[model samples]
Target: MKMFLCFFVLFILGFDDSSSQGNVNKAIKILTKQVKKLQESNKANFEATNMKIETLKNESQTNVKSLDEKITNQYETKVLKLENLIEQTNLTKMDVNSLFGEITNQTEFLLKAMDYKLGILKVGNAECSQYNILNEADRGISSGDGDNCDSTGLNTSPMWKGASWYRFLPPAGTILSQAAPGEDHCGTWLSGWCNATLPTVPGSTLDIEICFDYSGFQCWIAYDGKVTNCGTYFVYYLDNIRDCTVNLRYCGAN
Candidate 1:
C-alpha cells in the first residue's frame, strides 16, 4: 500500500509539469507572431515617408526652374524691344525722350529679375542735386510769344503755384541723360532739353531739344540722348509747369 501511494503522487506531479510546459510554448508562439507583424509595419511606414519627402523635393525644384525661366524670357523680350527702338534713325526728339523713359523702366525691371535669379544685391541710386529759379537775363531763352510755359521769361513759383523752370546737374561721370515732363495743365505742354560737355581735349558739346503737346492730357517728353564722358559738366532743363520731375542715375567712372 505504501508503494502504490508514492507512485500516485509522482504521476500527479509529472502531469502538472507537462501541462505548464505546453501553455508556455503556446504563449511564446503568439508573442513571436506579434513582434514580426510590428517590424513589417514599421518598415513600410519608413519607406512611405521617404517617398513623400523625395516627391516634395522634386516638385520644389521644378517650380523654381519654371519661375526662373519665365523671368529670363521676359527680360529678353524687353531687351529686344529696346534694341529695335534704338536702331531706328527717323526718331524725333520726343521719341528719344520716350525711349529714355522706357529704358529707365525696363532697366529697373531687369535688375530686379537679375537679383532674384542670381541672388545678388542691387546697388543704390547715385547722388543728385537740383537747381531752380534760373536767372532769366542770363539763362532764359524766349519761348517766343504765346508760349505759356517759358514766355513769361521770369521763373514762377513752384509747380503747385503754376509754371516754373528747373535745372538739374547729374553727378560727374554720368553716361545717360533723362529728361521727362512733370505735371499737367489745361492746354499746356511739357518740354525737356539737355546739354552735355565731353571731357576731351577739344571738349565738344551736345545739345538736345524735345517738345510734347498736352491737348489730350497725356504728358510728352521733348528730348532724350546719350552723354558719354559727362565728367566735365552736364546740364538738363525742364519746364516744371507741373510737367517735369528729376532723377539722375548711371553715374560712375567713365
Candidate 2:
C-alpha cells in the first residue's frame, strides 16, 4: 500500500508538468503570429507614406514648370511691343526731317530771285538817266513792271486771282479763273505762270508772284509746294496747292 501511494503521487506530478509544457508551447505560437502581423502592417504603412511623398514631389515640379512658362511668355510679349514702338518713332522722325528740308530749299530760292530783280532795276535806272531816247523808251514804251515779265510792255497777269481781283477780266490764255467774288483771296493759285515752266521741274526754283488785291495787304504761299510732272497742268497745279496748304491757317494781318 505504501508503494502504490508513492506511484500515484509521482504520476500526478508528471501529468501537471506535461500540461504546463503544452500550454507554454501554445502561447509561444500565438505570440509569433501576432508579431508577424504587426511587421506586415508596418511595412504597408511605410509603402503608402513613400507613395504620398513621391506624388507631392511630382506635383511641385509640374507647378514650377508651368509658372516658368507663363513668366517667359509675358517677357517675350513685352519685348515685341517695345520693338514696335521704336520702329514707329524712327519713321515719324524721318518724315519730319524730310518736310523741314523741303521748306528750307524753297526759302533760299525765293531770297535769291528777289536779289537778282533788285540788281536789274538798279542797272536799268543808271543807263536811262544818261540817254534821253533810252530813258523815254524805258519809262513809257517797253519796260516790264515786275520781276517776271515778257519782252512786250504789257503787264503779266498773276497765276491765281483772289477774291479782290476775281471781277477783273484776265487776258486771253488764262489757265484758272477765281471763284470768290468778294474782297478776300483765301484759296490756292492754279496757273502755269505762278508755277515754274522752262527748265523748271517740280520743286525747282521759280519766281512766283502772289498778288493780294487788298489795298494794303500782301498774300504769300502759306507753305512750300511740291511740283509734279503730270501731263495735265491743272492736276499739277492742284497737287502743288495741296502741299502748300498742308499746315496753313487763316490769320488777319495786324
Candidate 3:
C-alpha cells in the first residue's frame, strides 16, 4: 500500500511541472510580438519627419528665386523710363545733373545694369591712362600727339588735376556745326578745325564729338549751332576745321 501511494504523488508533480513550462513559453511569445510592433511604429515616424523637412527646404529655395526675378524686372523697367525721359528733352546742365543725381542714389549694381542696357561706352582700361598736352602755334587747330593715352583718330587732353577732355570722330554722314568755346580752365584749348569728310558724301562735314567734364561735373551737347548741357558727355559740332583739339578735364578723377 505505501509504494502505491508514492507512485501516485510523483505522477501528479510531473504533470504540474509540464503545465507550468508551457504557460511560460506562451507569455514569452506574446512579449516578442509587442516589441516588433513598437519598432515598426518608430521607423514610420522617423521617415515622416525627414520627408517634412525636405519639403520645407524645397519651398524656401523656390521663394528666393521668385523674389530675385521680381526685383530684376523692376530695375529693367526703371531703366526704360530713364531712356524715354532723356530722349524727350534737350537737357540743360542742371537737368543732366539732376538726372545723374537720382541715378547715383541707386546701388552700384543698378548703375552697371543701366549702362549695359543703354549700350553706352564707359572709358575702358586702355583709355584711363594720362596724357600730356601738345601746344599748337595757333589756337585755330591742333593735332593729337601719338601719346600713350591717345588712340588713333582719338585725341586725349592732359587730365588736369581737376578735369578731363576727349575728342572722337563720329560716323560718316552726321552733320555738325560750331558751338560754345572750350573752357579756359581745361589747361589747353583746341579750336574747331576738321579736315576729315564723310567717305560716303564728298566734302560733307564730319561730325566731331568733344567730351569734357568740368570741376562742377557738368557736360553738354551741341546740335547745329546750339550747345545744351546734356548728360555725362559733351558734344560740340564744328565745320571745315583742319584739326579739332579740346583739352579735357576729368571732373572727379584722381
Runs with alpha carbons beyond 4 Å of true place in candidate 3:
1-19, 83-254
Tell me the tens digit of each residue's lDDT in model 3 across 127-212: 22232222222221122222212222335433211122232222211122123234332123322222222222111223444433
lDDT of 1 by residue, 40-102 (tens): 888899999899999999999999999999999999999998888776644666788999999
lDDT tens digits, residues 50-85, model 2? Answer: 999999999989999999999999999999998999
lDDT score for residue 209 of model 2: 37
The per-residue C-alpha lDDT of model 3 at residue 49 equals 88
**Winner on TM-score (1 vs 2):** 2
Off by over 4 Å in 1: 1-19, 85-90, 94-254
C-alpha TM-scores of all predictions: 0.28, 0.33, 0.27
- List pairs with backbone clashes in candidate 1: 181-243, 182-243, 182-244, 183-242, 183-243, 210-222, 211-222
TM-score between model 2 and native? 0.33
